[model samples]
Target: MKKISSNRKKNHLAWTIALVMAAPFACASDVNFSGFLSVGGGMLDDEDAVAYGGYDEEDLTFDRNLLGLQVSGQINEKVTATAQLIARSNNDYEVDAEWAYLSWQANDFVKVRAGRLRTPFYMYSDFLDVGYSYAWITPPQEVYYLPFNNVDGVDVYLTGTLGIFDTSLQAYFGSFTDDLVLSGAPADAETRNQIGLSGTLGKDWWTLRAAYHQADLTIDVTGIPISQTATLGSFVNTLRTFGFNSNADRVLVEEDDVTFAEVGINIDTGRFVAAAEHVEFDPGDAILSKNIREYVMVGVRAGDWLIHLTAAKAKDEATHPETGIPVGQPLPVVGSTNFLIGTLQAIANSQAIERDVLTLGTRWDVTTGTAIKFQIDDIDSPDSVLVDGTVVSGQQKVFSVAVQTVF
Candidate 1:
């Protein structure tokens, strides 16, 4: 099976890397370590919009503290090994050997590296360090949608010249595991085994990158909730009165298959740096409704200020996929439109769906590595209106401000 094969490949990659690391090496000099923390306070226009209230409308948190220690020293003049430990919010950490292995500068026309490393999935992925990167406020959530974007793997990079233009070729193989919670269900883990190829070509002020990737993912959702449960006490009472003894269990689980692919571009000319990305994800039968998610965003920097404008929309057609009713058309009902009755009808008449989002924001660097950001978003939905003999309108606006920095 494809899944079996992918799993095997990942296991093999891990074993191979472990063996390479185990082969004792010559003693290297001093190791290096550094880290930073970004504590922020923010306010949201409406707290109800958040799926969970881990963050407050106004509170300070070390949600962005990153502790990293790297060890790197040269083997001869051309070979090196580097490893890092990335810490999380709960004071826990993971070994992120961002770059480990041997590099051979074969010649003026070719170069190669082998070991565990990072694949250039996005512009910022290569520099996810909190202390070094700009942004006290996290990057826009619309585009930075992927919860975890790294792979434990091996990579090969080739660099050369094509007349007046320069080029680089990169290929990689690896696997990654991380939890994703799209709906109100318990988190599920997505394990990915993948391989990809990317290339960059350009002259001076301009360069472009194109990449193709294929990943096999298995989603484990055993503890996640499937459908809404009615009142527990009511169900238990009815069962007891009927002289039935049953261990009423209410839990749902569904496995999922996923595949993701993306392409993006970046450009910088003296006083300005511009970038944009477009990505798509297919969560086949994963959580509940979302079968596909797609979005794109563009941003620019000028002076000490960064102005970013983004628009993104996601539609989960499966939210109310089946209402246990025959599908054809609306049922005609004569009488005053009752809010409760209409709401029930809407639930029964058609599957509930939503599409809405518009975002705009700006950030200014007030100091060397600290900045302030303000953002506003407007939400709209067509089906939000109730059938009250007339259309009932509903809309909400969200505004937020925060300070971010790394030390």
Candidate 2:
């Protein structure tokens, strides 16, 4: 959902490193090792086009290069520890832990996990970082938009059968703090009181998934003061100072409630496949618009070769509040009250999402655990988006190829 900034701290105590450093003390036979790697490159073909998935017309780069290693060790009869350490080329090869947790098998049908875990907000959340786990070189950004992928938390998972459907349920609560890419800028951000619930039912070649997640989000992007408070906050404070409290309440983002909801259906037979998902995001009282995104895909497989086509789109709904301030009324030293209100409105409108992308791709299995893929994506954004008050082209055509292997 978000790109990590390059200036992240490097000396933090990551659970992946902690677990791996302690691996030597455990019995060598108790620990198992597995890994995956992907090396990819792509280029955009048009001038004045926005970048997609980090590919641009300026230069062809291997930002898609990534390698990850996983280790699991049995701690006891009922407990086990697992960790995954990943190095991404885009992050300057800095190792990060996508998963590090201890699982306790309470019974045949129930399990508990604690420590760092993936946020189960999407159908592919568990393997979101693993390119080999999915058919597309990259999942649709419209639907796969979220910045926090992992959380420090605990979760309970239960599995059972309901008549003809195999059912699994997951419930979790956690917190996440890191640098977030908001409005194309890196900012210090945090999410708290984050809770999520997801369930899946499957039988035969058909599967169904639904999930809901909500959290209190805060992004610190401080700047010039419109008054005594910060830029964003001064608007609310000024509104309150002028006794227009209702308007102020509509645009406050400090610890505001944000939610995500999604539903997905998939069907697959040996030679044919189809899948679709719909997702919505609501940021309560924030200066960002509500967003809805969806995608549909169909594919066919013949022998070791497969072809697929995908269509994805995203739309935004504005939640801008009419501050009721008179327009263009001049003030002393500071613009007009309308300028303050218009700034807030522009902030909301700037984040409006309007994107549609059509993708044609193919995959070939070169060996038992290795595959090669090529894809072309035609993106069309009928409506332009604003970034830092600047308008730019949103259409880009990208061509890419990748080699993925799991060992």
Candidate 3:
């Protein structure tokens, strides 16, 4: 899926519409064009100096205003092609292609797709951008905050029945390049040689899912403030200049291996629904911190309204790499052994994330293909236990409402 990050405004409606209008000509088969929209506004009830989920106390923000258009066509009995375009207010309406791929049906239970594809790192990844398909105003942010979403590659899927259970399996290979925000700094990010495998099993009212994905990642942030005098990258170079090759290598994020593992469960019993997903991100030999994120949700249906409660938590441990240089040991220049150790530790521990959130929400299906939703979110963060941010630890709250429709 695509995101409207930072601030850039554009009128890409014409571009998006042109793609949809030309879908028929691109395929010999009948074309299907569908669209979805989420129009809404949200604001933080307090905490002027800080922001959460694009909401601030200064004013009402429509950052959640999002639009998506999907086009698909059956190329043949065994093949199909799909493309999706998305625009968002936070991105200033600059349109982006969220998905563009061709799929091949090999048999009754096997399928394959290749091209620019959504990364299936999570359970809801296939429809992450489709607001009308899911129950939450948004998926649990903690688990969904993957560094990147789309990759250019291929995936294979298999589905069948196993005794009393239905089963599905997927494996994919791809690479992605994009801009990322790491530790509040903009950086060029790349993930290469990605491989992922996932499986799901369902029996009656419950389903279980598990997945694993891994890649070599590199990040280049310009002029980060981790070092008061130089960027971390530059500091690493300086360490190399002093023949501290081993120390320099330990602090760099060049082609570092990273892995993600997930397990989730979902249950639906006519009037009740429950789901939970847990994920862990591990960065091996990388100075970046590691994270564990998870969320649990439960809801009940009464007439047209589905009321729910969700709790999410994310925690990370700062990586503190040993520099080999002992404290009080002599150094070749103005910096001491302890100074080198401190800088290495500082760079390693710079990226730390910790948050806990509780949410209460209601969704009303006013009519087919449309819905209205309202939600209240309370956030408690160890990082947000601020000193000068003008917000007390217990005062962080946000309220939001949205109307979503698919047509």
Query: Which is better, 1 or 2, measured by TM-score?
Result: 2
Candidate 1 residue 402 C-alpha distance from true site, Å: 6.3
Candidate 2: misplaced stretches above 4 Å?
6-17, 20-25, 223-252, 324-330, 383-392
Clashing pairs in 2: 1-146
Q: After superposition, how far is residue 274 of candidate 2 from its true place, in Å?
A: 1.7
- Would you list the clashing residue pairs of candidate 1? 43-57, 136-404
Across 1-407, the per-residue lDDT of candidate 2 in tens digits comes to 36665334422435544555466427645777899999999888775667787676656666789899988877777777888888988888888877788889999899999877889877778987677767788778788887778877899999999998999999999888777666544567788999999999999898899999999987664432333334655666666766667777666556989999999988888799888999998988766679899999999999888899999998888776765767787765456777667766776666787889999998888897888989999998863544345666777888899998888
Query: Per-residue CA lDDT of candidate 3, range 9-81, in tens?
Result: 1213323433554564475657788999999888887764346776766467767888998888877788777
Model 3 stretches with alpha carbons more than 4 Å out: 1-27, 330-335, 383-395
Give the clashing residue pairs of candidate 3, or none. Answer: none
Q: Alpha carbon lDDT of residue 125, candidate 1?
A: 58
| Per-residue lDDT of candidate 1, residues 1-407 (tens digit) | 00101223433554455445434344544333344444433344444443111343433343434455554545555555555445444333433443455556666655566665565665455655552364314543444455555577667778888899888888888767544543333344445567778788877766777665666655443333323543323433433343333211111122334555556666666455555555555544332333233334445777778776656554544433123323343333322223223333433233223445566767788788677777666656553433344443434455555555554
Candidate 3 structure lDDT: 0.78
**The CA-based lDDT of model 2 is what?**
0.79
